[model samples]
Target chain A: MFMAGNVINIFKKELRTYFTTPIAYIVIAIFLVLTGWFFFSTFFLFGQTELRSFFTLLPIIFSFVIPAVTMRLFSEEFNIGSYEILVTLPVSLNEIVLGKFLAGTVFVAMMLVPTLSYAICVGFLGQLDWGPVVGGYLGALLLGAAFTAVGLFASSLTKNQIIAFIIGMIVCFTLTMVDKVLFFLPESMLGFFQFLGADYHFQNTAKGILDSRDIIYFLSATFIALYMASLRIQEKQ
Target chain B: MIEISDLTRYYGDLRALDHISLSIKRGEILGLLGPNGAGKTTLLRILTGYLAPTSGAVTAMGFSIDEKPLEIKKFIGYLPEEAPLYKDMLVYDYLNYVAAVRGITRERKTRRIRELTDICGLSEIMHRSIHELSKGYKQRVGLAHAMMSDPEILILDEPTSGLDPNQIVEIRDIIKVIGKEKTVILSTHILSEVEATCDRVVIINKGRIVADGSTAELKQSSELEYALNITLKGAEGQDVKTLLSPVEGIKEVRELGATNGELAFRLVCDTAKDIRDEVYGKIKQRDWILLEFTQEYKSLEKIFRELTKES
Candidate 1:
């Protein structure tokens, strides 16, 4: 119980840090503007009442945005030497990593909250399927959390924020685009490659499939990335 | 109480701390005196559970560092060199965050922060962001952060490294006050700081323990030699040297200089014997008017240099 409380303390501090600076507002504004423009540009062209394109565009957009959100989690601490003070406190490394990862995931959720109006707007135009809409939001959360973990892992690799952002972007972008490059692979490796793509599982839930395998893949990805980030942080000591 | 036994640490092939052992008593203000890169910070880091030693062990408050780091950390407060803090946070918010992490309950948290704010003299700038504060104020905030939990042991690395004279005095006063109740271990290259604040001094040089004792003990343990300076109005330099040279316990009597027909002589005396009375009795036999007479012992500064000087 005390362990969980320490995690909450770190989480609260990290979230407070995010809002105290203008980074949160600027990133949120840029994310909303970009997602809104791209989603509406093709909303009428597809002539579909469902918000399928918005879900389709999510993994691509998040490949850029999530990295921006999580880039400062460890990079800034390392750069400023606050990591020494932080680790020396009574809290364990697991608490620090989990807390920061949750903060990044929650920030992604907040960024997604504004885009909910896209779902409501399309619902007003015609009969919209609530099943896919709910599944899409849930899948968006899992994918956001997974990408946030990957971004945090990348951020842990260096003290330079820009380098962290770029590394995170590259990793997230590769996961999003991994399935798209399957044609270059041999026939036997096709299924294995597609299984590794983040978008494939996300698209399954976005279509309201609710497959346990898809959900497990996202959760395991988050766990693995966070585990790697914790390992990297431990190496620093 | 803390005990470190044969603790060794190396960065790649570079050894930062050789095998060093120390035992610190409760409520002792111990000073770690060393030149830069002498492993003072590395030793403190290992004691605070921040860095693992390459060999040996540290046990603090009955808990071994390797088996129970968090337990050891709970009882120790540490301020790293330069007091690196999150520059963007407000002083109040930063302290509050530390209090929470240290597991201070919400009811006691406010009262605790209020006490630290008063203790560190941070009342005026509590609401201001940390980046706006000067270096001294930032160090005070770091002090407040370290003391948030009111731990049994406080370790500070060069707590007054770059402060102005007044700020240095103020910080020394605060450390003195805190030293009364806690086991305080502070490291510095400044000799006067150790003389002013420390009860016991440990001089480290090149990762090895060179000297460890109370400041006075350290001065006494080194070769005991002191100089007595005397100035005379009517006596010639040669006459004074010859007269005082025969006195017991006076090793040498050399004329320092002559000005305005007044003469000065320096008497090197062995501390094993009291030569002041004999010299004064011998001077009473002369017609020379005594101008000035003073005794100077070997200072801690000189002893420190001698101990830490490169061979």
Candidate 2:
């Protein structure tokens, strides 16, 4: 219980840094612009009151933007040498990692908040499905958290923010594209590879199916990335 | 109390600390003195549980560093070299966050911060961003941060390395006052820093302890060795050296310089006996007029040089 409070303390501090710096605004603006352009440009073509197209493009957009949001988390601390001060404090490494992870997830949720206006606008134009809309938002959160964890792991690998951002993008991009590259794989590996693709599991939730397997996949991905990040930090220590 | 036994640490193949053993008493101001790259920082990091030792173990306040690092950290406040704080946060916010993490209850947090603010002289710049503050102010903020939990043990690595003289004095004063109650261990290569603030000094060289004692005790190790300078008028360099060289306890007498009718001779004496009177007696018996007579006490500076001097 006390450990949870320690995580919250770190979380608040990390979140404060996001709001104080220009990184949060720049990343949020780019996310809104890219998602708005991709979602609206085709909204009229389909002439549907559903947000299927917006949700489809979210995993790809987050692949780029979420890395940008999470890139500074550990890279900046290591670059500026504040990690020494942080680790010496009375908090454990697990608390610090979890706190930073939550901060990134919260920022992603804030970026998604403004897009709710699109759902309301589509509802007014025609009959809209609230079930998938809710599911898409939920899936976007889980996907954002998993990608944020990946970005955090990348940030832990180096002291350079640009390198962290690029590494995070590559890992997230690969996870997004893994299912699309199934033709090269043998038939027996198709099931395994498909299950590994983050997009496949994300789409399951985005379709309002809410399968236990999909939720488990994102949670475990986050856990594995965070665990690896902790191991890397321990190695550095 | 803190006890470290046979502590050794290595970075790859490079040994940073070698077979170190130390026991620090409660409420003692101990100074870890060494030249650069002598493993002072490495030892402090291990004690604070920031780094694991390659061998041996440390126990502080009944908590082992390996098993209860969090508990050890709970009562020890550390300020790393240069106090690499978050540059974007305000001083107040950073201190508040530290206080919360230290588990200071919310009700007592404000009062504790106010106390440190007064102690560290940070009342005026509490709201300023950390990066915008000057280096001295940043160090003071770091001091305030370290004292947030009112810890029983305080570890600071080169706390005055980059500060101005006035700031150094101010920080030393703060450390001295805190030393009255807390077990303060600070590391520095500066000899006078140990002289001014530390009750005990440990000199390390090349990853091993060369000397350890109180400031006066370290000076006393070489107390038998001292030098005396004699400046005389109407005297020749060779005559003055030959005359003073025969005095008992005088090891060597060398002519410093001769300008006009004045001559100076330095006598290197290696005995505890006061040979100044004997030298003066010899000078009075001569026709030479004595101009100056002074003895140079063995300072910690000289002892430090001798101990840490490379072979």
Candidate 3:
């Protein structure tokens, strides 16, 4: 059983640590600037009242931004030899993995909070449907959650943060592109790759459909990735 | 209290800890003395629940380490060789966070922090970021972090390493104070550290317990005295070597370098014997001016060398 008290304590410590340092600030700043630039650059050019351009760019921009947020989560602990302190504590491996995962996801979601203004501004320009707008933010969170787990898992594989970030980018990019890469493969493997493809379901949810299947896909992916990360910690013991 | 039986750990095929067992009592400061790569750190890690042994049964304070690691961890404070401090955190904040993880209540967290600050001599720098502190101060903050939960067993691994001699003594005094209340397991390769602080010593070599006893007991057990240094004024190194060859218990003699014009000879003796009296009587009869004749005590270093070299 994963104790809520231990997980919360670990989460609080990680969140407090993020605030005390410049890492969260730098990451959030870069994410906002890049996403905001891409959103506004295409906002008026698309000229329709939809945030389609923004949500499309969200997943692509997040592939890089989420890695920056999660690279230090485990790599720093291992690099500085503080992983021993964490493991020797009374906390379970699940608590550590979840705490760090939630912290990174919440940080990315915090970065996404400012983009809500983009949705509101489009309302002033024209009649914007709230369904797709809300759907876009939900899509961002779901996709961020899934990518955060992959990045978190990558951080556990090495002690160097830069290598973790590179590995995170590669994994996230692969998950986001499994569908497109399947385009070149033989037609026989289409259903399997589409099921494995992150964008297939992500695009469906971004279109204002909150299908439980898509939601389940993201949740199960997050669970599996976090479980793998926890296994890495257990292996260290 | 802790009892370990048939504890063995293997890193892949290489055995890091052989079949060994020991017991620890409350309020006793035990020093784990061993050469580098002699499984000192591996044993401490097992005791602290950070590393599981490949085969063993370690029960601490009525709990088995394998089945109830969390229960064991609640009672133990472990400081690894690197000290495991978060360099980005302020000393006070790091301690507070660790307290939370240890499940200490909010009402007592502040008081515990204050108490540790005083014990670790961190009152002046509690507000300072860990990265800004010197290595000595970082070590102190690490000490405070380990003691945060008010644990019963405090395990410090090479706590005095990477410090100046003055800092070493400062940390030693703190450990001495901690040992007064809690059982302490201090591991190091420094022999004098055990002599200065520990009540019991366990010397491990080649992944096995080579010796275990008090410091005085270890010295007493080393009755296999080997060498004595002697200096002569009138005799050349070769002449002195020839003069001492036929003495009982004398096995071999070699020049121990020159000191001005006086010839120095290091005479190696057979086990369970003393050749000092024979050499002295012969010198007195010949009336040869003996400048210096002293046999160094068989210190822990010699015992460590002899035991480890044999294995």
Candidate 4:
């Protein structure tokens, strides 16, 4: 019970630490500009009112932004030796892991808020289906969370933020592109490889198909990555 | 109260602390004295529950560190050597955050912060970011954070390191005042600070406790005799040695050197005996001019070396 309270305390502290600086604003600004450009280019060239272009471009954009937000989560603590102070507090390991994960998730959620204007503009300017739009938003959130979890894990691997950021981006990019490279493999092995690809599940959700398997995949990835991050932190102690 | 039974720690195969056993009473100011790499930091970390021991058990306030670490942590405050602090946080904000995490009540958090701020002399820098502060100020902030919860056991590792002379004196004064109420354990390589501030001393070397006693008791238990350097005028080296050799309780006498019509000799005696008066009387009776007579007392440094040396 006390551990839960500490987790909430850490969560609030982590969130405040994030928003107190300009990192959150910078991430949101870049996300908005890049996503907005994709939306405009898609509308001008294809004349399509659908969010297909935006959804297709999101995995690529998040490959960069998620790493930026999570690169400092554990790396900064290690570099500053604050991890000693934190682990000595009357808090459990699970609380520490969950608190950081929730903070990253909240930041990702905040970044998605401004993109709502894109959906609003598309709805007013042309014929738009709300079902796929809702699904696309959910898919984008899950995809972002999955990438954030990977970034958190990578950040836990090193004390240098630059190294963490690079590792996170590379891991996210590889996961995002796994499906494309799996095509040359045999059909029997392709299915297993496709399950590892984040874009495969994201595409299903974006097409308005609520597959339980896709939901499980995204959640499992987030859970396993976070679990690995917690283990890494423990090993460092 | 803290009872550490056979506490041992290792970094991989290298032993850091070797089956160290000691008990500290409540409200006792204990100083951990050692040279660098002497396992002072390792023992403090284990006692504070920041690191687990490789073997043995530590029970603080009746709570085992391994069994109930949270309970132990609730009663202990730890300040590492470097004063771990978040540079981006304002002083007051950082203290408040620490207070909240330590489970202080919302009603008492503000009052406690103010009290610690005043006690640590942080009132002026409360609103400033930690990064903008000096090294002394950062140390005070770390101390304030540790004291926010009013913990019973305070573990400070090298609290005076990197501080200016004035700040060092100020911090020592603060520790003296706080030591009256809390069980304070501080580690330092400075011997004088231990003599001045610590009620008891635990001297460690090569990952083991070599000596443990009060400052005076440690100095006495060394059993090493004092050396008195005497400069005599109009006295040959053999004459000086012969006169001092026959003095009561005198162990040995050796002529060090003579310069400028002055002779210098070292007198060794039993530590529990005072042979100065006998030597003075004999020198006066011989009509020799006593140019200089200085007695060198047993220092903690000498005792430390004697205790750590191989038998």
* Fnat of candidate 3: 0.88
True A-B contacts kept by model 1: 0.88
Q: For residues B25-91, what per-residue lDDT tens digits would candidate 1 score against the true structure?
A: 9999999998889999999988887788999889999999998888989999999998989988999
The digit string of per-residue lDDT tens for model 2 on B32-132 reads 99889989999999999889999999999999999998999999999999989999999999999999999999999999999999988999999999999
Give DockQ per model, in order: 0.86, 0.85, 0.67, 0.67
Q: Give per-residue CA lDDT, model 3, range B223-261, as digits (tens).
A: 666678888887766667677788888878888787677
Question: Candidate 1 chain B: worst 10 consecutive residues by lDDT?
Answer: B236-245
TM-score of each: 0.97, 0.95, 0.88, 0.93
Relative to the true structure, candidate 1 reaches a TM of: 0.97
TM-score, chain A only, candidate 1, equals: 0.98
The candidate 4 chain B region of ten consecutive residues with least summed lDDT is B302-311
Best by DockQ: 1
Task: Mark the 10 consecutive residues where model 2 chain B has the least summed lDDT.
Answer: B216-225
Deviation (Å) of A150 in candidate 2: 1.2
| Alpha-carbon lDDT, every model | 0.92, 0.92, 0.88, 0.88
Off by over 4 Å in 1: B259-262
CA lDDT, candidate 2, residue B148: 89
With a 3 Å backbone cut-off (N, CA, C), the pairs that clash in candidate 1 are none
